[model samples]
Target: MPTTTGMKGGGYYDANSKEQRSASDAFLPWLEEAIAALPEPASHQQSWNFLDIGSSEGANAIYTMNRLVEIVRRQSDLPVWALFDDLPTNDFNQMFLNLFPASTPALSATDVYTAAIGGSAFGRLVPPQSLHLATTFNAIGFYETRPAARLPHFILAMHPNPGAPREGVEVSTSELIPFQKQAHQDLCHFYAARAAELVPGGKLLVQVFGRNETQSTGHGLMDVLNDALLDFVEADMLPRSFYEAFVFPAYYRNIDELMAPIREEPELAAAYRIEHAESRDVPVPFNTAFASTGDRETWSHSYISFLRAFSEPVLTAALPQDLPQENTIEKIYQRMERLLIDHPERYEFHFISIAALLTRL
Candidate 1:
């Protein structure tokens, strides 16, 4: 299976981004502070440009942008131009529709303008020295390309195989190191690109998935899906070839990996200052609600729906074109639903997120 580069479907992401919404809401105070700290534009004529990188469907963007506009209005009457950037395949139409509802006036009758810029966030999406502030939420984990290593066949072998030794059940360093290196390189390029686009005193706030210093590299959902796929292989429901060849582009970095370039590279160090960096465990709300209510069926449906919304497109793209896409996808989700129903406790996994505030110098 060839590696896919960008997130294609918008509806799934929009529907399943509760974790993203929570994370963004948690980071709003920092966003407001960062925006407030930005040096005023040289003159009143200069419009405030706020760029939202990896903005999908504008659900979270709407809330963030509104708060930003409110803050900027208090300081100055200058026009605010909000740029929303994402892959070309993103659901931009839906984003615009949500942002500019017919019943509501745009930006509360303030001079706030919204536009979409479609492209990869890993590359340059705006002009040099154009933005006053930039924000990315639950994005930037996606690398531009997949690592050279093939997807491991026995990804879930560590889950107590009854007779097997636990010592050798881990994903080896050989399988993980290459991807870590790639992720580090991708972030360096991303920072460098943003460094060029931002003004000297501009600020950037980013929130992304992260692991603790001791935690190993891997995504929670990816782990669950790996096990689910392996189960399919065991039951002869999915081809082993497809399972081995599948690769997810998402790569989460530890705090050290995330800040490595800024700390070591002279150019980055000189161009960007790491104002604040912190990690927190972001709980899955559905799981929390489930734990209190003990509703297995509702909890299972909610958790599986979230997973299916985000992973369906990627999994679908990995399959051969000749497959009956709709039926196959439904079957896959059906199996996933059964897995969650059987093991309701699996929904309690908390996503670890790292948020950083950077200033361009």
Candidate 2:
């Protein structure tokens, strides 16, 4: 229920179609490039291991595993272990197994590390000095805001927000701040600790949504929905804190915002360098059919759905009194359809984004 000034996190959406796949496709080449920047194997006998943190659905992890298998199979017969780590509640383990079911005997073996890394006070999920390569693709921005600023009614306006109590809601900032600050502190600690875990020559490749002095946010399905949320609030359909709780969590940091966390840690300051930090231009196509209307019901539904996909956790945690848990999905759908039909052009159909790639120290 905490509130930061900008987007909180990435990769918290329920994209059932090929949309997530498409974004991954766009990310693969840059990932390959980042991996290439790592120190090369001195010999075919060199061993390597890969880990993905905050691995929501494990698409990127699987992709990286498959790619590595291909590379090693062609170059050397070295054994490689690929691990996908995330919260225990993350429902991606079975899906990841389903994706790489063959259990290839030659190239790599898959392992699942289901732990709540974010919940840890220190955020050290992987054991120290064990990992060789790690990649986190766009899932690090889920931050909590200042505890005092949470609101209850904002939940009603968040598009796609699925889980929340529909009854009367109330939250005290005092109750929310400690937990959120701990989470944020732990997250930063994780990157710093992970940097320590890596071998001297080992590399940690991070492809996160970041900014470069532009007024833009991040990328992907959630970004589009967040943009819509900003619109709804500005039009007076939703409260201002609604934007603070839900919309701000999904944004990317500018060059300074991206570097501030890492720079604060002296251990990482010397080891880490901006290996490749630049804002990227990502063109995204939003659902324009819903944007051209002013209908409250239609817009409400869209807003709820968007919130469910991107900001549900914050809304639920911060505004439990107003957002009941009963029949939430039905209400959200009804609200979205009403909003979309009312203003088909109320939202942007397509837009471009800025991104960054941070390499190991």
Candidate 3:
């Protein structure tokens, strides 16, 4: 049998990650271009190695991997072996099952090999100088672990967008730095690890839910979740300490923030050449549906489902160990559903993403 749940957050992130899927779709051209630009495999190499870290159950991950193998087939005859990786808790059976007879039009060839590796991206999981190309899509916003400091003000590290109208909520800039610093170190470490694993001319494409000039990918969703947490607290359903200790470990960085280390830090600067980098506003299907149909119930359900998919695991973990974690989580999501269904106007969600293509220098 395969390891754990395919998609973390209880197999919820994949179906509800419409925003992430949109980001990958929007960034596909760049991904294609990056694949085309990869250096030819060395004469000593046996196969072209490709990897997707933080791929949740190979949902979007499989789609992109199929395309990658297809592109490489057009350019090289070398056998392609793809590695799909995520936390050990992630369900990998679906990813393995989907490897053959690719979801894409091409690359149905039998020569391609597929496998799953379970681990966090922060550690080295591959051999030295083995990978030819690597990609992580709509992931990496999450830290391996949360900072020890309490986020008493909000559930997420960054502030909710001002355009989002949640009255009486004050965001603390003081709370942002620890997470930002940790994220930077984490990214730098990730690059260093990849640099060691990738051949000199190997390529990496990274697309993540990210920040822009005005707001972040998480802007309004976090706001609603924040309010819901407080409501639970006020209702005596959750402990004050739970609220204080909980901060979404994810940090969505702007393109500038993403580039800081690759452009400035001596080690990363030397290891990678920035091939492509851009921040974009990706479409949200529920938001678009809400705008088009004026159907609050459908939209609210979609919205809350998306919220629970990514946020539920951490939220459930925040509860006291003795608490009925699953039941409590369900109730909290129920409240979240109501909150959005009743006042869909106030909680607006927009998906923002940043994508970059890098070359191992």
Candidate 4:
């Protein structure tokens, strides 16, 4: 299985993160309300700390930071310290470039100060009891590493047959248990880390992909891409070994799974209280645009571009280091685009996001 890393290409993510932006926008109203409800900080403190975890390319970060500044200023004129955190390899340059454009002046407004911190959110990214409010969107699903239960086949066990293990094979129930356990542990760790960093009464708002007991969360996007891969394998256009070995390092947790850690663990329960937790349906923007314009080709391109932006790095890393990296990546996306164009109805689906607001005790 491939290890979790930063997003693949900065340019693609910057351009194709409309879905992420929409999700963030949806949560803004709730965030604004929460900020308004927060107790005023100590009089001695001159600034408030706002941290944005996994701020991919600053597309949403720009809006989030600006909105936060607006809300915080309502209570006080104190300057706000906005910090953006992500993996070390993340495109910090692009993030800052977009955040503060060349034509505009620096983000040195007397009311808000901006800085980028490169690190993983799984660990201590900031000083303990320093941050007042924390926000993460569409990034919590990426665990620190792949689970120990290594399925030689796909990243997720979605195949029909559960008992057998072959190239591109299904995983049995016994084999899949480790992944679930690992996910629970990963979430607990993330909460613990954030709990340590946040001050008493601090609030954390998280927007991540989720599913209920009877649903699959990628909104059928992963299934469609999986089918495209299966077609390439059958046609011998790509090696079966390569296809089987490729695993995307992400896991979508349901509402129960997300709350389990806090509910079951004494320390986590004591440290945090769930203020609001619910699932929301996130419609696909590419599908909406296609519906309005009636352009299948543009929709396919946009959908493929979004997927490729996130998947390319993981897929490329999974391939053998000795293999030539010429047009191999392009071909995979090309085939995926063709599959979507052939069946446009597959694009019509909604992604479920579990939005939770937790306050430190």
* Top candidate, metric TM-score: 3
Better of 1 and 2 by lDDT: 1
Candidates by TM-score, descending order: 3, 4, 1, 2
Candidate 2 residue 81 C-alpha distance from true site, Å? 1.0
Instruction: Write one digit per residue (lDDT tens) for candidate 3, span 242-349.
Output: 887777778889998888889889988999999889988888888888889999889989988877776766665556876534578778878888988887766877
Question: lDDT for every model?
Answer: 0.73, 0.47, 0.78, 0.76
Query: Which ranges of candidate 3 are over 4 A from the true structure?
Result: 1-6, 9-11, 100-107, 165-168, 323-326
TM-scores vs. true structure, each candidate: 0.90, 0.63, 0.92, 0.91
Q: How many backbone clashes are present in model 4?
A: 0
Query: What's the CA error at residue 207 for candidate 1, in Å?
Result: 0.8
Q: Over 4 Å off in model 4, which ranges?
A: 103-109, 157-171, 322-325
Question: Which residue runs does candidate 2 get wrong by more than 4 Å?
Answer: 1-27, 40-46, 72-74, 100-122, 144-187, 210-251, 263-265, 285-308, 313-326, 349-361
Q: After the best TM-score superposition of candidate 3, give how far the Cα of residue 169 lies from its true spot, in angstroms.
A: 3.2
Local error of candidate 4 at residue 56 (angstroms): 1.2
Q: How close to the true structure is residue 24 of candidate 3, measured as C-alpha lDDT? A: 81
The root-mean-square deviation over C-alpha atoms between each candidate and the true structure, in angstroms, is: 3.4, 8.4, 3.2, 3.3
Judging by TM-score, tell me the better candidate of 2 and 3. Answer: 3
Model 2 TM: 0.63
